[model samples]
Target chain A: MVILFPSKPSILACGAVAGPVERKSVFYSFFDSVIEDERWGQKTNEQGHSQMIQEACDILMKKAEINNLDVDFFLSGDLVNQMTPTNFAARELAISFIGLFSACATSISSVIIASLLTELGASELAIAGASSQHNAIERQFRYPIDYGAQKPATSQWTVTAAGYALVGKHNPEYPSIIAGTVGKVVDYGEVSPFHMGGAMAPAAYDTITSHLKKRHQKITDYDLIMTGDLGKIGLKILKAMFAQSGAKQEELDVLRDAGAEFYGDDKAFQAGASGAGCSASVFFSYIEQQLKIGRYKKVLLVATGALLSPMSFQQGETIPCTAHAIEITME
Target chain B: MDPQEYQQLEQQMTPPTPYLKNVLKAFFVGGIICTIGQAITYLYVIFFNFTEQTAGNATVATMVFIAMILTGLGLYRKLGQFAGAGSAVPVTGFGNAVISAAIEGRTEGFVLGVGSNMFKLAGSVILFGVASAFFVALIKLILVSVGVLEW
Candidate 1:
């Protein structure tokens, strides 16, 4: 079922922190802060990831003028084992924490959940965020950067970024979150780790189709329909799926992938950016900026994830992917 | 459709890896690695006035050390990606595996983190290496004792 928040919870403030590579992208201006170092002065990449999350949350709190005492809940996730980076970040913050894992799509998932809780009065103020570090994610999902492994054109570089948003009662000044669609893990029996976009495209399409159907709405109803980290291949796959399903050309035009938008013409990011921070950084920074500037009144942010592991890939299991959709609008 | 049919259909839809190209690449890379080892052994023998056997041992040690340093620098993974099994089949790959684990575990601390977790990957390699060595030694000993082989 599409979760309809009639009360329309507002994201009061949001902050994004990105690494040097991400800061070089076109979306850099939207972020609250940018760190030149991916290491963030931490000895280990994993610890650096936790540092990014904490810094992002602290930045959000500072931006929103909200403290740990004011935040009733903190929801977050990252593309790491046990979501350790986010969990560790939560520990540092000392807030009521709920760790989540939906791979790269985690930011949107956290935002949707936080919005739902805030709308239901579960918390007067809630913080939702997601983070991913290039080194940390590379070590876990693929190979180490030191390996100097050649990345295929299909492989998406994980964004070294983190983003956080504060959710509360709807205010005319802020973007109001209206609804969220929790996704189902859909496996089209794709097993290749290289073709993550291909593996995840089906799940994104499934979630988008379901959300549209449930709401009895067209894709064109929103000013922008964003998909999380589909990369070029996944975006192509999604477009093909839409065309096959007989979706109108206008409807397809509304789709804007975070992967493409964040790193347009940046060949450094092979296909595009992936990881939990991909969509999170894009939404909390670029998209939110547009919303505030009265450019996009309605936005559908669909975060996608390929729920697979190195072990699972090694064992020849198919990639089970998912995508969660959250509708944010301006009244 | 049944699960079997679904699997078949999915396989059909999925893109196949270019096995021929990959095999050719692997062969070239592996050959290059072996040639480098041979060169190192020759260099050691000529420069240090060591015998061929000692030079070979020195080459192996040098390669492992170089591999660990490259792994620490985060360059070995890229090599692994490009060369596939070519990089992995060599003794250097074993070194990379061990050092990578140690790097990952270093965050926990020297004893619990580095010491305990360093062997997580290489432990099996060492175990099988010793076991196989023992087995082969036993076989050689038995053959010699039976007068079928001479030491």
Candidate 2:
């Protein structure tokens, strides 16, 4: 018999990791960049940053009692080639599985897969998780900073962390995957491929509307409605864009996150955070943490991933992206 | 499976290494990858006589190509084991991801398969570079036009 539940069994053991960074630094700079069209050089990596993700994932998996084998499948990803950490680790552990997902929203996307698998009797136990290592993000996506490049304010800081939740029937109330809405590609030729994510808030706005349409719930009904780290600009644009959809950000005190903002001061940054892990760890850690605090009832997690193509860029394919939304009830 | 076997499997599945060791392993492996980066930096300077900025720009494209090949040979996951972030943190890392994804997609179509989807994300990175450079050029032009900032 298959059962479904929160990734955490005891409900006490949910985890998320966001590096320390303040929000204001990212917020102010993000707006400045968008308006001023500021130029942010790439962010380079410093020492001791890469391990932050590996450590976080290893710890959370251990806490959840998710053995590599017990996990029927290892559905995870990274901003690296072949999803190195997750892929290599899964290989070493010999956990044969499939990996499918949408960028920052991977965590939620996978959780949805795990839930349906568990619910549909395909598997009893499974691990649905995703990680983002800041080091790799910096090196791959932007400059490592050791190169001493100044960043424009709208740039997103990559967060180095991994968040995981074991999905199964551990608790009755904390249903791991309740319901979710899948996002569609929304592109306006005005947004550049590199700037595709700028319109990501619209993607989020689109998914949230889909979820609302599906569930028939008011925006205020959910205890929290968290979007994947749109960073500052993405979030603000997301909030503003929702106006067209009749969802007002001012009305909802829903927890907003740009996990990159956790990096705090001493770092020149913008927007908020912009990484797959930024949302993964932040959502996992925050939802789990707040579940304990007894503050939230329902949570909406909408994660956005940018889909861009080089051939498209050469041929000039405007960035075409898709997002997925997952709703979990800590009932 | 027997209880003993199940427990054994669990133990084996779990990272037998201590947390700190795993963390340090990631750090060192990542560091080794960065060392490659440093070497590349040196190459950029000595051979091309390019400024660090040009060198940095070139590094992204170069590393991405290397990552794509490594991903094809199925060596990246191993490197990822030794250096989690070190492997994933560079432009090459993302290249590896997109290329591998497209490679997997190849199972569906050979002619229009992975090759077609091959550069799913390369556009964004290239766009990021080009757009930022254009914006920077515009800013520099404005600055040059005024007397506040110099090129």
Q: Which model scores highest in lDDT?
A: 1
Query: Per-residue lDDT for A116-216 in model 2, tens only?
Result: 77666666666666766555555454432222232334557665555666666546555446676667876544234323346465567667777776677
lDDT of 1 by residue, B29-145 (tens): 878988999999999988899899888889989899989888887778867777877887888988887788888767679899779877766788999999999999999999999
Provide the lowest-lDDT 10-residue window in model 1 chain A: A143-152
- TM-score, candidate number 1: 0.86
Candidate lDDT (C-alpha), each: 0.85, 0.58
Per-residue error at A207 for model 2, in Å?
0.5
iRMS, all models? 4.2, 20.6
DockQ of 2: 0.02
Query: Relative to the unseen true structure, what is the C-alpha lDDT of residue A82 in candidate 2, on a scale of 0 to 100?
Result: 53
